[model samples]
Target: MSSSPAALSGGTVANPRSRVILASLIGTTIEFYDFYVYATAAVLVFPHLFFPPGNDATALLASFAVFGAAMVARPLGAIFFGHLGDKRGRKVTLVGALLTMGIATFLIGALPTYHQVGWLAPALLMLMRLAQGFALGGEWSGAALVATENAPAGKRAVYGTFPQLGAPLGFILANGLFLIIAAILPSDDPSRPSQAFLDWGWRIPFLFSIVMVAVGLWVRLNLVESTAFEKTVKAGKVHSLPLVSVFRTHTRQLVLGTFYMLATYVLFYLMTTFSLSYGRAAVNGALPGLGYDYTTFVLMMIIGVVFFGIFTMLSGPWADRWGRRGTLIGVTLAIIAFGLLWVPMLAGGTIGVMAWLILGFSLMGMTFGPMGALLPELFPANVRYTGSGISYNVSSILGAAVAPFIAIALWSWGGGSPFWVGLYLSAMAGLTLIALLMGTETRDVDIEA
Candidate 1:
């Protein structure tokens, strides 16, 4: 490989670019699967298995509160790992993050609940969740930047979408694993599963991360440091204080990127966690047979993940032509339209559920696909990692951290109307729209600092 700055800056798809994209996307997929499994468990099983049994509603909320605890720790993780990524290298930071996330997830599988260990259970559980949060804070932005920077100049948007697809892929695999478990367990209530499910089935999925971690470690270790980072280092131009430099130079970009992602995260948690519970409650109140079971819900998400993946794959080519700003703006507007239809689908039967799943997931694909390239584009090359990571994670905390709680509250307050959740999603999406209109476009900008 050429060592010249020009050679590094003139990236192309014909070389090892595909390999780099694959490495980032697969590693991120594995990491996110490990992360989202905990969120799913929090909503579905952790309250009963781990927490003290008091009021059912309060216990569930407490379980989700623990989920939010990790989001709170993400910003600190971003700063810590962002420093390493900028100064050291993307590969090294990712190596450490993968191990940390894997260990934390593995421990969650082995944990003893309140029945066995008393207060120590929730305490230990929270500690592990925070560790997971911290690791993931660094994982995504690093992966996205690696993929985008490695792509052939003309195909950056498309290559960028590869890493973004990891989100939907992770969701698909996580939910698919849970769906398999649900199907295999003797048909009773999901909350009160057959003895086999409670005895050991739940642990299987969490423990499965060990295999994925091993594979991710193998692939990532074999990969080279990103050419862009190496060029910056050779130029002696790497920011000594990336976090400070990022804020000072790119505050507006940071703010806009944060808003851009806010609604995406919010709607994501709502679709996966709160909707399941709300749908169940609605069925219980109305027609018992009309409610979607755990298996059905997971299956719907799988379908949505497929569409999300497809649309994300399509985003790159589109961005190269229409530009990242226009693509993102179009997607953002579509999301609001999707939100308007969310309630009718929830209140309706099987047809309605299918309609919402297809529409929402498709819209998710459109926004998320362009976001990988767009967010990193906001900052100059020197502090790209830190600025993008901080914006993404902070927005995650604001939009996603409390999404389930907010959606549930809305659903309950609105007397089971999914409309309120839609309204909440719209408001969050509206913020992104305003930010988009106000922010600068970077699609045609050069990557070199």
Candidate 2:
């Protein structure tokens, strides 16, 4: 772990390329898995078990409210963990964040239901959700920096995608397990959850996170500090407080980076969270829905996530070849266009719905992949952790934290049509497009410099 000014001047890495990929990818995979596990349960189980047994809409909104509360805590987390990351180092900060998330998620499984503890159930739920958000706030940027900083020349974006790949992989694993559990405790009706699942089956995913967290810790513990970080240390450039430095000096980049991710966040939450509600709603509502079963809809989303994985991998090369800004601009434009297809595609039946899922997930992959490189590349190594973590998590509040709530309100107002939701997506993408246009290409930038 010793780094001299001379060794770091030449940028000597303690970790090889393979180690870089594994460390970055494994940490994020476990982190995102912990996240998606809660996300799936929030929709499928929380409303029924944790909230007061009354209005379904009220309960669901309550669940989402707690869910979005985490977004508020994320920036705080970014400040705390980002400080540790920029000053102490990425490896230790990442390990700490992962452990925090794992512990919170595991404890969530054992919490008492509303029937058992009344308001305390939801209160405790929000507390744990906030912990998850805080941990995730620092996790993504640290993982991204680890990958990109350790990358070989011209391959930063390629390596960046390794960490971004965790989103889809985690989604698949989390939901795939839920699917298996649902099978084990089959509901009498496709439309409703089995009593067994509501009572106990839902806890398994949350409780299982500790095992994955252990493996992530092992991989990350073996990682040495990256060359870029070493160089920064050798140069004595680590800031006293990266959060203050980033805000004071990097305001423009911070604003641009935050908005740049808006469309991706909006599109993502809509596709997964809102779609689950829309897909499984009654066919005879005021505007009418597709009337899918819970399992059927989740399965559809999982199928589409496969495309998300494939395209996520593909976007790496595209970003490397064409450059991160230019590539994101192209995909952001496509997202704007994709927003218009929600109504028809969703209404067209299973095939059309599948088409919508595939297309949405594909655009999601393309846009999200480059962000791993693009955000950290927005700033120098000195404040990279704070700057990137803040911008990224701040976007979560603007886009993801509110997207589902807004979309649901819009859906009801539109009489169940997804048209307004599509417009909302397009508008967010429009802002992202403007942001991308202002951003410079970072593909050839020397991140360690």
Candidate 3:
């Protein structure tokens, strides 16, 4: 195992491994916290608060469209931040991304609703959402590089999963906060004139991002740069234009990585964002839904996310032993099978919903775990940030950015049936399976190469 420089220099920390993992994990947790909070609000609060209160379907679609605007901005964020991350150091670019995301999220919490500011409310929300996307574009790849580059040899997959843990942890924290807020300001009845949750409860989660950002910045600012990046700089191998070099030399990796991540991105949004909308919609209405009360569904999602976190950790060691490609292939097959069974699972009511979510999240963890290592390993040290960030964020556009919007459209087109959504997911998983088959096993590769 290679012994890289510890995250804390000068001082002798007994466990440098813990420091690096925690630094990466905490920063990603903050990023996902800001990102997922907006996702939750897009489904729960934005439709009602930002859009004109008429035509439930149209309003929800508009809210989701606004939600997707950030996704559209992610690649641009990737290009900008990726260039900076490759040119400067990973640690500095990460700090900048954190600050950008934090300020945007906090401002979102303070924005006026449609009732107070009319069309201006959504307009401002759109801008904040774009900022969030830009920041997040750089966050994941940088965090992954930090963890994988610092990992002891043969343990890169395990260490890389540390950043992946943030996804489920962030999901839990984001929804858990919303769950508490919903409980505190209990809605008497949805039919009632007063809706406490829509009025003020939703803002609490977005407002709380300021606290998370502060702590993340503290942890990240104290960390040293990755040893791999330091070596590249010392060797004078740093590319003057990483984006150009990445395209010129590693275009295939970029294309392969993007498609390789398609299923993971699709599954993530479908389980977290799309399901929230599906669970809370009116069952007997023109657009049939599961008829679950808002709080009940949120609690269910929190429970499911717990399983996602556990399996995410478990997938790390499994990938290490089984090989990254093998683990991904098995998990992708499971995802395809799960998609095929979506109709029956979702139709089974509360028990079905629980089963559906738990199974979906478990698969999400398995597939998502090794990605932190897998994506970064696809590129050499010099352009790792630019290549991986652009690939991952571009995949977000093709997958997550359009997932909820696509799922909702499919559902509406299918007259509320989940079959089309299932087929869509299956198709995505199929693409990932092909990519995995074509790609090499990156578990044993040297990230600094």
Candidate 4:
């Protein structure tokens, strides 16, 4: 109940290291669970439920546009919450972000379909997606600060990675839940015996966020504030306007960090969202698709996501040993190679599809793992939250916000060839490689300095 920052910062946790790590991991997992469930639904259900009758391709594009709206909102969320996290404390901002994201996700589930509410349906969907993005803008940077700031000397990369694990774990849970519901619910085809999945089955996954949000809040409420932020408060060094300080003092770090993340965000949406849409459409129809069945593609994705989780864990220790910059550079090169192989590998049928997912995700893990520590380490403690959050979210706008839409457009431009998409990804990786080379090594830096 104290208004003093020091009192609030030190309110909980006797063992800050491990408890903070666990708390960060739990909060991020839940946040991303809410985030990713919408992503899956955008591809699987939103086109039918929210968009008016039109070309399936145009309908699908409309759904993805709504999905991208969240990414556009993310930077604004970052600016707002980042200031609070820097001035107040990481714990306070994180809790507020979780509540915002949870409420938005729950409302998204309860929204009426186009048939029921007409244009109001898509409009409401866009608003909710914007809310989700805004909340997520603060979530990742806060989690990274929590884990990295409390980490043992020389182990920040490994500790930071604990929060990064949430992405894969959230992906697995979101997809697994959808997979279960998809199995239980009837196919989209009315000709099938039971109810169509698009009609109501997809809502189950979105509504399920209510339970996960409760669990995340329980764990996060017990977390003590990050030690680095606590030290800043005790020293009376907290910025009154942290966003101004971030832009004034850390502009170069912000730019480099944002570009460093370009490849990871682009590849993520490409693998999960674009691939889902690509695989499920009819190959011989007016729109070109791979002609894969829905259930089979989801199952394959679940298997691939499991590997994403595994390598996400492994990437921590790997980055600790290999150096974050070195690990990212090596992995970015591999992503470039993988980008070139996308058409050939995917063209190989089911086995090839599996290979593509495994290879892409494995590389993604290696690169994404170090980002938690890397971005936070880029700036001093005074501006860590704001700098990292803005960098990460801005990259989302450039990379993920338009990735699927771009991929779809490129595919259409290429006459169904994936070459252009592959080229796009490879180009992003090239930019990331340049960013890595321009940045300094931070694994040995003092976080509180």
Top TM-score prediction, candidate number: 2
Please provide TM-scores, in order, for all candidate models, with all chains considered together. 0.94, 0.97, 0.95, 0.95
User: After aligning candidate 2 to the native by TM-score, how far in Å is the CA of 351 from where it should be?
Assistant: 0.9
Please state the error at residue 33 of candidate 3 in Å.
1.3
lDDT of each residue in 101-199, candidate 3, tens digit only: 999999999999999989999999999999999888988998998899888888888998999999999988998888788778877774221387777
| Best first by TM-score, ranked | 2, 3, 4, 1
> Regarding TM-score, does 1 or 3 come out ahead?
3
Q: How many backbone clashes does every candidate have?
A: 3, 0, 0, 0
Clashing pairs in 1: 12-152, 157-316, 158-316
On lDDT, the candidate that comes out on top is 2
Which regions of candidate 2 are displaced past 4 Å? 1-13, 285-288
Positional deviation of 443 in candidate 4, in angstroms?
0.6
Pairs with steric clashes in candidate 2: none
Preferred candidate (lDDT higher): 1 or 4: 4
Q: 169-266 in candidate 1: lDDT tens per residue?
A: 88888878877887788657754556677667888889999899998888777667776786788789898899989888888889989998987788
Instruction: Return whichever of 2 and 4 wins on TM-score.
Output: 2
lDDT of 1 at 254: 90
Each candidate: what lDDT? 0.81, 0.90, 0.88, 0.86
- Give lDDT tens digits, candidate 2, residues 252-355: 99999999999999998998888887888879954356788878888999999999989988999999999888899999999999998788888787899999
User: By how many angstroms RMSD does model 1 differ from the true structure?
Assistant: 3.1
